[model samples]
Target: MVVQRLQAAALLLGPLIFALSPFFWVDGHYGITGGTLIALSMVPWVYGLIGEYERLRERVPTLAGLWLLLLVIGMFGSIAFGLQGFFEGVFDITERVSLAALDEYPPHSLFLLWLPGPSFPLALLAFGVLLGWTRMAPRWVAVLVCLAAVAFPLARVLRTDWVAYIADLLMVLAFGLLAWRAWHRPVAAATSD
Candidate 1:
């Protein structure tokens, strides 16, 4: 029970940190750092989710590991991009080392504009689909998460900032539903194995 509570807190904290990052970290490097932290926070929740579904684990042992792999890749990619900002801040070399082609873009917007940005959401989509296939939760929960996943990549394709916010909101909704389910799930169900 205590483990579940901690897992729930980790699940909630990932999004909370991400949502508040824009405000708390104005420096672009710090923002990316926040993203890295957000990614780190998600690990325990993922582990808990996998653990909660013991039957699923017995049937498909590799799925949860795959999800963790993707999450780590996405987070590390974020950190890699953030390194540019770190270099800029630490060495004061802020003349746009290699981003000259994006002269018209905002200073740090480029980080979220491509590559790693789309990968994270796509990974989530895959994970959500797998979770749904396992039928460990209501189908609608998976559907909502899938919808949220779509929003992120769509936002990238559209090249608009507001769309990402909508995606974030959708993710929050999906995660909120998961949290509710986790909280209400019977102890016997969790301990059945």
Candidate 2:
């Protein structure tokens, strides 16, 4: 019961945190606010993993576990990036930083931070696929999640925000609905009576 509530909270909170990112800070590299929120959002994502375990059990335990592990790796990456931003901000390093150095090095250039950017979506897409396979969610939902994840990179490459924005919105809605269903799902009576 406690976990369910936390899961619901996390579902609601994660997107809210992302929404706050833009207003709180501008530069992704030098700003800690966004990355920190991304890191903190992991709590609910774990709740999501827990829900998967309860739903799939041994049938797809491996997939559920994999999702959890990868998502966690992504979370840790977000934390590392956030910490890097914090250090940069504290030391006032952004100004002294060179464009050439930034182009070459960049913030979160390390595997941890970079990998998570994609890993997080991959994990979600995997989980969504599994859910679709189990008929837990509509296949369209899973498809949309996958499409959205895929669109992110394309959006970046194409230099368009619409794809990313639409994809993000879809994910937010899908997760929100899933969370709602999970949290509101009724428990069976102990006895049929």
Candidate 3:
């Protein structure tokens, strides 16, 4: 259970941790430390989320699993969009950055920081309403998570960079709640009888 929460936290933290990379970039090399941790943290997130979603499918029987894949896609799209700078080394992201200040940032990848944060939450909204709120997912929790997506992101958007910082904090809370619910649920034996 702790492992599951850590994995969920890793998924959310991967991007937030990246935001803090500036402080650790020593001598032009973020080093194996930052690079490795960032890279390694993703594995468990993918495995854990996919595993949990699959289990949810067994218990619930819906296309929620595929929608989770949609979340993964938007995540990668945001990552790729943000990394428009790194893309410049091999291809041309100049058009992508047009007038952005990061056009000249070295190792030239800082532009990846620009990935859109609100998209995944929005995507989850549709999936949750269609699949979970009606019958499968814990109804109240599903509703709250979706609402948190809108409220937190909207609050941030109205204020600019506030969205990124506050969104990270809120996401930590959301994942923590998932962990709590998953952990505290009655054991299967209690239900099977």
Candidate 4:
């Protein structure tokens, strides 16, 4: 029972955890040093959602299962992109010697713009919509997820990176709320008859 609940929360947590830079935005750590832990964290985030979808599949069927599968893939892809982009920038600096450094590679607004920014929001929003439709997560989380999807792109349209940051903060809040709700919910006993 406890394990089931933990698994459920882990599922909701996968994508959000990935976004919080599951791979540490670690500095001075060099190459795969500090980044390895960050990159490795993606495993749980990916499978977490997969496991959750398995549980959800028994309940929500239909498009919900499909959405969950896509989200799981999308979540992993986002993490990979972030990792690859960061290190690629690192290697570029090393090869160039003087062209630039990691710090200068992925600029302040690189993620702050482009399709890269929407991937997570789209994932979250899709998950939220699916969960909300099933009443698995608090309804407000679904609203926020949809809002994030809309806001991030709109902010970029308006030329405001702060909107992206704000969207990120909201996602963290949604994750916290989902975790808290799941943690507090009464766990059904595996032994209960």
What is candidate 4's lDDT per residue for 76-123, written digit by digit as tens?
A: 545554455466556644423422443475664354323344565576
What is candidate 2's CA lDDT for residue 49? 57
RMSD from true fold, candidate 2: 4.5
Q: RMSD in angstroms, all models? A: 6.0, 4.5, 7.8, 7.3
Residue 129's lDDT within candidate 1 is 85
Give residue 126's error in model 4 in angstroms: 1.8
- Predict model 3's lDDT versus the native: 0.48
Instruction: List the pairs of residues colliding in candidate 1.
Output: none
Residue range 1-193, candidate 2, lDDT tens digits: 6666666667656755544443444343425565465556666656665665667665777776776788777666656655655666666677247333545765546564566656766776677778789877678876766765565345433533455456557667777777777778665354241
The numbered model that scores best in TM-score is 2
Write down the lDDT of every candidate, Cα atoms only: 0.58, 0.61, 0.48, 0.55
List the lowest-lDDT window of 10 residues for candidate 1.
21-30
Residue 193 miss distance in model 1 (angstroms): 14
Candidate 3, after superposition: displacement of residue 20 in Å?
5.9
Instruction: Give lDDT: candidate 4, residue 114.
Output: 35
| Candidate 3 lDDT tens digits, 36-102 | 4333434443444563464566655556666676667545544443343234433433443543655
Model 2 scores worst on lDDT over the 10 consecutive residues at 21-30
**Each prediction's TM-score versus the true structure:** 0.66, 0.73, 0.52, 0.60
Runs in model 2 deviating more than 4 A are 27-30, 95-111, 151-165, 188-193
Residue-pair clashes, model 2: 0
